[model samples]
Target chain A: MAAQLKGARVALEVDNVTKRFGGLTALDHVSFKVYEGEILGLIGPNGAGKTTMFNVITGVYKPEEGRVIYYGEDITGLKPHVIARKGIARTHQVVKPFNELTVLENAMIGALFGTRHGQITEEEARSIAMEILEFVGLAEKAEEPAKVLNIQEKKRLELARALAEEPRLLLLDEVLAGLNPTEVAHMLDLLRKIRREKGVTMIMIEHVMHAVMNLADRIVVLHFGRKLAEGTPEEVARNPEVIAAYLGDPELALKFVRRLGGV
Target chain B: MNDTIRKLYTRPSALIAWGLVLIFVVVGVLFKAGLVSLNTATIAMDLMVNIGLALSLAIIMSYAGYVSFGHAVFYGLGGFLTGYIVYNAVQTAYTANPQNFNLTFGRALGWWLEGAVLGALASAALAGTVGAAVLRLRGAFFAIATIGLDYAVLYLVKLYHNPLSGSADIPVTQLGAIEGFFYKTYVLVTVFFIVTVIVAYLARVSKFGYGLSAIREDEDAAEVLGVDTTRYKVYAFILSAVLTSLWGSITVWRQNSFGVDIMFSLRESVHMIAMNVIGGLGSFLGPTLGGMVYYALYRATLTKLANSQFIVVGIIVILFISLLPEGLVGLVKLVRPKLRKYID
Candidate 1:
């Protein structure tokens, strides 16, 4: 289940990754291979260490025991910028936008530093940022300060900022967390368009079960910082342990399955 | 250079704002050429240097979002370096070796230039090392660390009695023409102020400037988005320090002597920070505007406003921080957002 990448290139390989916070074991021996041009869903209940997994992958926190291999190179213990420079980009669960900078400026920071090439002109960076903002439907609010954006727009701003990096792999942490249902649907369509059009590899930590079921190509479930289940949406939904750990009630599980267009 | 000038002039109100600043410098020069009393010239000189100091710190604080309460350490070091060099040169030609007299304008000018260059290098090196260590502390912690560093440096100077830095003033009295020195100081101060204004402007509009603002906005996000926060912070600290050191070195030349009290005064750091806060933290015109306004009030009061000038200044600052935290530039943007682009 772990090495099978559907005949696609492996973009990232998290091998036996373990993380700890004092006595708390945040992530323990989690292994996953993200293939090119596919969305890998990372799901779990509260205190399941979903965001910590993203943090470790993005170099925000180092895993105590294992390796984060990106494009066949070991990127463990690298700085966040160094990882970003190596085509790994991530958005925060809390949506950390640059409050004082304009929406476009927030995006340009990504284009300037996150891009694969070094030393781009400001004009080039601005145009690239503008394109990303347009793609995320945030072009209209380019001149406004990031602080002024609504939650959904801020979420889009985060997406645009990460997209501006031109990253080969994008790690999205709870992107659908605070969105309204309509916004979630709109975002789901947008994410599909991103994968379909850009051919990007993605690893997303989401609590929206139906959304993850509909969007992710493969599902990986975590319980108490360990891999509880991994498979297609149908297979994961049928796993009793995953259902008990995450879906909790059988009736709720049926409703979630129904919402994901049923399997 | 052409592009910078174009950017500076094409903005809606840049012409008027720059015109006002240039007019002030022109008027001071006119007064000096007219052989006005040294008192008026001295005050004008003081205004320019204070403006320079205020603008220098704005790059790190306003641009990069690192408040340095011990910023005067660079200024003091630069001043002391110049003082030491000048003292040795003067002592050798006049006292130690009178036969090898070289106190002419040409010789003295050469010495001052060498001193300024040395001062910049020393301050930049120290800032690089110290900023890397201290800048790891964010927000108020970084601010508090700087204050502690300032006090520590002050005490260290007080303890170690060097020819350049000590309780007693070091003599630098071999100037070929005292009047010539003051006039040159005025011009050099103007040049330095303009250069700093450009540096501060470039820091705001350039890609590097944007990266810095990103750090100021949210350091974690900046790093994740690919900004090397550690390296950029140190770069900004060194730039702020070098400019500050240059100002300090020139102050020594104009004043003819310096001591620990005046060279490393905590009061000077307060003035710089207070003026920047009052003007606008990150805006280029903010500190310049704040410097002029504060200087006018100080000069007009004639030391009659209070028992001590600092007490009055401190009270005013407290009011500013509480009531109008955005400062004058923020107030300007609030009233007329359209005009905001021109000032920066």
Candidate 2:
């Protein structure tokens, strides 16, 4: 698995990115690389800079130090819309749907202004949005206002909106945080299908251990705004530092390692 | 291009806009035929001005969700700039040969048109520069910043004195030298009203409009989703400013004078906002209808209650806000859900 990842082209590279808010460092010199067509799981304890990392990469918060490279081009400190137009798209952890707009309209906004914006007409964008809604299983609710969607449905809508951008790299922030086991399994399957069909590289920030472990091609564990461990799920699951920082129990860590090895 | 035209024609908002312009055209024809009284024609022109102002305000307020409490600054700029240019031109022509100077109808109209064009350009320049700074502030801060913009421009004009007017007040009354000056201005105002409605309709249904609504809903989310929030806001502001300024130019013609105290009145901004709120906050039809309804209510109550006419308008605005926040458009949507898509 490691050898195959090495052979693949690098899709995104974060080099020594440091982000500080006032005197507090949210992401302290964090560095990581995501390979093409892979789902890289970003897992960490609460306040371990996961969402901050997403913000930095998406251009919401400019990092105090270091650069973000996407397909060999430096994109650090560019405006969010500029980054988005460069084929990078993301979903927020707390779902931010255009509440008053119809679900279809919400998705249509992504295509209307996203990566291929102005290249496609409104009619073309409508069809693309519809196709994405269908893919995310929100086709039936397309005409309904996005505010009416339940949490699980809103998550799907978020995913659908991001996918409508036709991004080369997709970042998903805590998409499975509030879902039940069945919904998680469903979302995991959809994510797999997205990668398989669209061949888009994805970086997922997930706290759901089982889903992340089962779905991610590799795992990077963070602790207190620093990288604690980086390896295959099985390797990360067995690492002492990752277990100490994340699970905090040898027995629980051992059980997770067994579950990963068994899978 | 053909499909886009077809879509624009079928749009309910566009239809509403065209309908309003058609009503004004019919009124103009009636006046031309001598079937309507001059007083009624004048009233219809005033109605057009009211609606035109609301529609201009709607571009930024309703569509872009930026409440400009100082929008009257542009209106004042339009009036004063036009006043300045017209006054200077007439003065120059008069001074060149005082006894023989005769301001013809065509010459007077040409001067006013020149002033309107220049005023619009100035308003655009102001909005483009000021919007870049103030639009960065959102919500109530943005609203407050605009009020500051209003005061800053008002004071700047005052401190500079009337370099063009050659006095504190500009007397465009000399333009009354032309026969039927009011009638010509009424015609100009009507044409501009139609232009404003077309602009408001186009801004609502375009890709630009979608980006604006997205920004209104969630600025950060909009930015992240690839809407250039700053550029769109500034564009909308400039459009709003230019239209309002043109109205201001015509206003100087209608009033026959320009006074600093009256031209930049904060009440004008408040009235525009009240009209928008009563019509429906973001719908294209709302402001157009709101302006008419508000004017009717004001006219009806003014004759009976006199000074309390504003009290009546105030009560209606409150009722609309409390009972139907979506205004007249919301009521229509509730009555016919199927018409919702067609309406906006």
- Candidate 2 DockQ vs. native: 0.75
Give the runs in model 1 whose Cα sits over 4 Å from its true position: A1-5, A261-263, B1-21, B35-43, B96-102, B162-168, B173-179
- Model 2, B50-135: lDDT tens digits are 99999999999999899999999999999988998898899899999999988887997788889989999989999999866999
DockQ (Cα-based) per candidate?
A: 0.66, 0.75
- What TM-score does the predicted chain A of each candidate obtain versus native chain A? 0.95, 0.96
True-structure lDDT of candidate 2: 0.88
Across all models, the iRMS values in order are 2.1, 1.3
Candidate 1 versus the native: TM-score?
0.93
- Model 2 chain B: weakest 10-residue lDDT segment is B1-10
TM-scores for candidates 1 onward, in order: 0.93, 0.96
Stretches of model 2 off by over 4 angstroms after superposition = A257-263, B1-4, B162-167
In order, what is each prediction's RMSD in angstroms?
2.7, 2.0
- Summarize candidate 2's per-residue lDDT along A169-191 as a digit string, tens digits: 99999999889889988888899
Task: Give the Å error, residue B60, model 1.
Answer: 1.2
